[model samples]
Target chain A: MYITWMLAEGHTYKQMLPTTPGVFMGEMIVVTVVGADKPGIVAAISSVLAEAKANIVDISMTVLRGFFSMIMVVDISGAVTDLTDLRDRLERKGDEVGVKVMVLHEDVFRYMQKI
Target chain B: MTKYDASELAEIIEMLSFQHLDIRAVTMGINITGALRYDDLGEGVREIVEKHARGLRDAVKEVSSKLGVQIVTKRVAVTPVSVLLDAKAGDLNEAVRLGVSVAEALDSAAADLGVDYVGGYAAFVESGYSLGDRGVMESIPEALSSTERVTAMVNAASTLSGINMDAVYEMGSIVKETANLTGGRGCTRLGVFANAPEGTPFVPGAYHGRGEEDPVINVAVSGPGVIENVVRSLEDADLRTLHDAMKRAAFKVTRLGELVGREVANRLGVKFGSVDLSLAPSPAVGDSVADVLRAMGVEEPGAPGSVLALAVLTDAVKKGGAMATSSVGGLSGAFIPVSEDLGMAEAVRKGSLTLSSLEAMAAVCSTGLDMIVLPGDVEEHVIAAIIGDVMALGIVLDKSLGVRLIPVPGAREGDEVDFGGLLGKAPVMPVGRFSSKALVMRGGVVPPTVSRLMKG
Candidate 1:
């Protein structure tokens, strides 16, 4: 266990509860990564999800000049690991690989009114 | 126990850990009013009890198991018990009994299905009043308190008839009383409507109108963050460019709604309703409709300059939404629902906006008269006047429009009501010091007399 103090509320903090049984299992969600282009980026991240035993439902990649971006929607209900830990690992891996990765909850994406 | 173990679970977890999606809600509509007997209103209610449980029983159980997704909300929508009065006007006793009947049916349905709520105990008096309307309205406070999962609405006024001030006066107090009913739970389940559209899919408010037989489906597509991101990405985009971007964004978003809706219908075995391609904004961060307009260059969203901003955005949004879905029907366009939207409410609270500016926006947007909060003590005639403005717009444009106004008790203009959460906080916007007695006093039914549109 860790005890820590942090600066607060002006920033929105969303607390994700454990997805209920029979609801979130095998759920699918889309993720996107955008940042300066670098080598071995896709391999580094895909391998992380692969190691976590997540299913890659769909994926697309593009190299926008000096920056590289990729969008992937994955199903991870059957994953061998906890989702929170996987998220932490991905953030660290992103730091390692030089590309910023952001995960989006699919249903949240749906409810959001597009401009 | 952990919901899943390794093997398929771990890999799936890893992939979804950084993945994205949300499930808005799962709603069920059950009709219970018919269960009331010709004279035995109570047993007629008992029949409704059996019907909703038996009819929807297998559907809910089967869908939940197969979808492998927990249904977010299990609700019921029933025939408006308010209509019970047409034949039983003298039966205030029966009206009260009927309301109790429907409430018990809702209670039993929720208990049976383990669903949170049921809807469609509603009254639609768009143009004129019926004795049943009055009876139902009178009993709603009692009905709301007595029921579980039984949500209700009264379409007290509409765009065509201007507005019924008497209905306004009654509803104003009724909602206040209803909110106090059952420790505020009733407030969560109730909605008061004006210029209500005929067939909307979501509720506490959805009803299968008597005139509609097709089981029409209308999809409410939402994605404020997506649109905000799109608009944000276009920093220097001109209005034309903005429209183009939104159109492209809408096309992409509509494709998503179409996919899910068709799948839901396929599984449920129902005909598809029109996908309402409304950019219904919510209170989530970065998911604001007003932010898009602000991003469009109206830094102060409620200022005089913003009216033009709204006009341009409303028109451009329609242009995009029309291009996205062929079945762009229902109240389609951007929703400026104050209580439901984060940015608009914030703008009002900060004095960046006013009711006048909101009404101006509605003139060109989809929801002609929408979720605006007026101050308490504003006369019924003033409310009627606003409704008149909305109805005029609807008649002139030949579109479906509605209003969901809340007059918070004891709140005045420049004061704010904290609804908390996604209902957001509302700033009581100013309604002009004016009256429409002359216009409203001349109240006759505005017949369905669209000469050219009817010709087609």
Candidate 2:
């Protein structure tokens, strides 16, 4: 069963997992967006992920000193596409929205941040 | 919960985008000992290397794309070519011919496999030379000159076995001969080592030693720019604070290597070897190790406090890297190769980084006197003395060190020569006019250090 969630900003992964246990069982990718604050940034990025059927397990966004930053934890195991194609789509979407988007496997953050 | 803040994510992004942080090399160590069983040595070696290195580049690319981290180079390291020559070579001429043929095969296979460099044209003769060792020593110049993408190393000293001055003396002439043969480019592909590590991923020294897995993936991580950025951000911070910051940065950088190495190995179905903690620098502006020293308040790389600064940096990197991965096996320290580092080359041109100071720094750093260019007419014995000095340090201090000296043909002191691409460019530094011929000529072996006899 493919499930997609648009969790509220600042919602932690732990908070969402219990609500829909085993629904987030997929390869998690970290998508970071950074650029000047602008309207509709979230809509544009979410559209691209929606087309690929990737689930947004968690998201956090903030604007500091006129610069916008957002981190999206996505589950791509149920997506129809691989990481490379998803990255290409997200990058093209980034170009359209004037933000620098980076799509990285969640393991990079886990390995570096944890131990 | 694995919690990560916005700042941590931002830091990783900045490192990848601006700090030039990347896995420097993913070298696959292939055991080629079985090649000697075949009648045709060169063909046997070619088939083995081809079979092992077939999918290495694709594997690296796939992992790099999946992780979104840049992998700069992919390489292969095979068993020492000298091992095959041991059974095949009947004399010096036969050794030279066989070595060149094998080197050509390695080069062709590397090109076909899309590998950057193929290492392990090597001989280990710390105490003395075997017939094959002598043959390899004699064949180095011709082998290096005849082949591109083939790197060679000779281990002439070790803590337990002492220094082999005979091979050291011969290597001097080999460097000169290679310089004359390849217009000094071949010398860049050769190194003389003391305590050369078995699983080093760095070229000119990487070789698959005995007891290693059939084919293993060993990663060398590059992060001088990352460390330099850390030091810069901590403006006016105390040395201890700066060290802590650099160590944290190293932890993250090494984690990247570990992730990339494991993924690449998993995809290739090979064992993951080790992540060399060495902060390998490139010719890029911000990526230089000298710049890292300068960022840490050293006026120039060879200035008075340079050694102390380098010591702190090397120690911090080792500490942080050791914590990050249990598999740390190569020359796990900082590298300050002159030509390959923009700031180090600039320091030489400014007359601030002298060869003498580089040797002193080598005592505390990884490798020794790397990619240093000398005047063409410099005597062979003087080169021998330079190598002997570093060899002594490696033995006495019981560390891994190596020398890659290039005596460029028709080039004089202060004259700049470019070796293109990753080899970079450098000015021909002046050597002592006084001869060390007398000392190097009276060579047999420097006895093992007293530390070797100490109770374990």
Find the candidate with the highest DockQ and give its number. 2
| Candidate 2: chain B TM-score against the reference chain B | 0.98
TM-score of each: 0.69, 0.94
Worst 10 residues of 2 chain B by lDDT: B1-10
- Evaluated on the second chain alone, the candidates' TM-scores are 0.76, 0.98
Tens-digit lDDT track of model 2 for A84-106:
99999999999998998888887
The digit string of per-residue lDDT tens for model 2 on B1-456 reads 255667776677677877889899999999988888888888888999999889998999999899888899999999988888888889877887888888998999998889999999999999887777877888788888888899999999999999999989998999999999999999999999999998899989999999789899999999999999999988899999999999998998889889999999999998999999999999987898999999999888899999999999999999999999999978999998999999999999999999999999999999788999999998889999999999999999999999999999999999998998878999999997687889999989999889788725
Q: Is the docking of candidate 1 incorrect, acceptable, medium or high quality?
A: incorrect
All candidates: CA RMSD (Å): 10.5, 3.3
Model 1 stretches with alpha carbons more than 4 Å out: A1-115, B1-76, B83-90, B107-118, B145-150, B156-195, B203-205, B211-218, B305-308, B315-329, B432-456
After best superposition, candidate 1 residue B36: deviation in angstroms?
4.6
Task: Report, for candidate 2, the interface RMSD.
Answer: 3.7
